[model samples]
Target: MSEELGMVIGRGFDTWKRNIGIAFPFVLDMLFSGIFFLLVAGVVALVIGIDVFLSFTEGAGAVFGSMEAGENPQIVEIFGLVELIRPYIGLLLVAFFIVVVGWIIIR
Candidate 1:
C-alpha cells in the first residue's frame, strides 16, 4: 500500500510538471486580481474619508474590546466596512471569475 501511494504521488507530480504552462497563467491571474482588489479597496477607503473609516474602527473597538485582553472577539463590528463597499464586491468577483475563465479557455 505504501509503495502504491508513493507511485500515485509521483505520478501526480509528473502530471503537474507537464501542465505547468497551463497552470502558470491562472496563477498570475490570481496574483493580479489580488493586487487589483487591494488597489480598488484603497481607493474606496480614501473616498469614504479617513475620519469615517476611523469612526468604524472606534465603534469596533468599543464593541469587541481589546484583542490583547483575551475577550471574545466581536468580528461583525469590524466587518461593517464591508457594507460600505458591498456594491463593488459582486462586480469585482464577476470580473475575477471572467478573467480566470478566459485564461483557462485560452490555455
Candidate 2:
C-alpha cells in the first residue's frame, strides 16, 4: 500500500510537469451562477417586502385554486413559468422547516 501510494504521488508530479493547464470553466460558471442567483433572489425577496412564508402561501393558494379549476393561474405562471415548481417549493420549505426544528432541538 505504501509503495502504491508513492507511485501514485510520483505519477501526479510527472503529470503536473507535462500539462499544467486544465479546463476550469465549470468552476467559474458555478461561481457566477451562485452570485447571480443570490443577487436576483435578494432583490426579489426585498421588493416583495415580506417573509418567504407570506409570498409562498399567497402564490400557493392562487396556484392551487387555479389548478383545481382547470384554468391557467397567473400566480403559477408569473413565478414558476411551470406548474411543477409549486410542489418542489413546498417540499423544500418542509425540509427547511425540519432542519430548523432539528437545530432548535440540538441547541
Candidate 3:
C-alpha cells in the first residue's frame, strides 16, 4: 500500500510539472499584456482628460466635449478630434468591433 501511494504521489507531481510547463508561457504573456494594457489605458485617459479640459477653455459646449466620447477640444478649427486621427475612424471602428467580439466570446 505504501508503494502504491508513492507511485500516486509521483504521478501527481509529474502531472503538476507538465501543467506548469504548459501554463508558464501563457502566464508570462498575460502578465506582460496586462501591464501594457494598463499603461496604454492610463496614457489614453490622461490625454483625453487634457484634451477635454482644453476644449472647455476654448468655449466648447460641456455636453458636446464630454469624456463619454473621448472628445478633444483643442482642435476647434479642425473639429473635436485630432486631425491626424480623423482618417483612421474606420480603424477605430474595427478595433471597437474586435473588442466587443472578444468580450462576447470571453463572457
Candidate 4:
C-alpha cells in the first residue's frame, strides 16, 4: 500500500511539473486584466473627478444616521447619490463613452 501510494504521488508530481508551463497564459491573463482594470479606473477617475468617491465617504455618516432613525437607507443612499451625481451627468457620460471605447480597443 505504501509503495503504491508513493508511485501515485510521484506520477502526479511528474505530471504537474511537466504541465507547469501551461499555467503561464493564465498568469499573463491575470496580469493584463489587472493592468487593464487599473488603466480604465484611472481614466474614469480622471474624467469624473476623484471627489465623487470622497463625497460618498463624507456623506456616509449622514446616511448611517438616517438608517438608525428608521428611514430607508436605500432611498437615502439613492437620493444622496442622485444629488451628488446630478451635477456631473455630463462628465459621467464622457467617462462612460471613453470606457466603452477603451474596452472595445482592449478587447
Highest-scoring model, TM-score: 3
lDDT of 3 at 86: 54
Backbone-clash count (model 2): 0
- The lDDT for every candidate, in the order shown, is 0.74, 0.71, 0.71, 0.81
What's model 1's overall lDDT?
0.74
- Candidate 4: segments with Cα more than 4 A from true spot: 1-49, 98-107
The clash numbers for all candidates, in the given order, read 0, 0, 0, 0
RMSD per candidate (Å) reads 11.5, 14.6, 10.8, 10.2
Clashing pairs in 3: none
Give stretches of model 3 more than 4 Å off: 1-18, 60-107
* Better model by lDDT: candidate 2 vs candidate 4: 4
Global CA lDDT of candidate 4, please? Answer: 0.81
- Residue-by-residue lDDT tens digits, candidate 4, 1-107: 35688899999989878887987788789999999999998996776566777776667767777789999889998887777667678977987999999999999
| Candidates ranked by lDDT | 4, 1, 3, 2
lDDT per residue for candidate 3 within 1-107, as digits (tens), equals: 35688899999988878899788899899999999999999998799778656655553444455634676534453554454355457767987999999999999
- Per residue, candidate 2 scores C-alpha lDDT tens digits across 1-107 of 35788889999888866664553566578899999999998997686455556656676777677678876666555654354355457767987999999999999
Model 1 spans with C-alpha error above 4 angstroms: 1-14, 49-107
Q: By TM-score, how accurate is candidate 4?
A: 0.38
User: What are the TM-scores, per candidate, against the unseen true structure?
Assistant: 0.35, 0.29, 0.41, 0.38
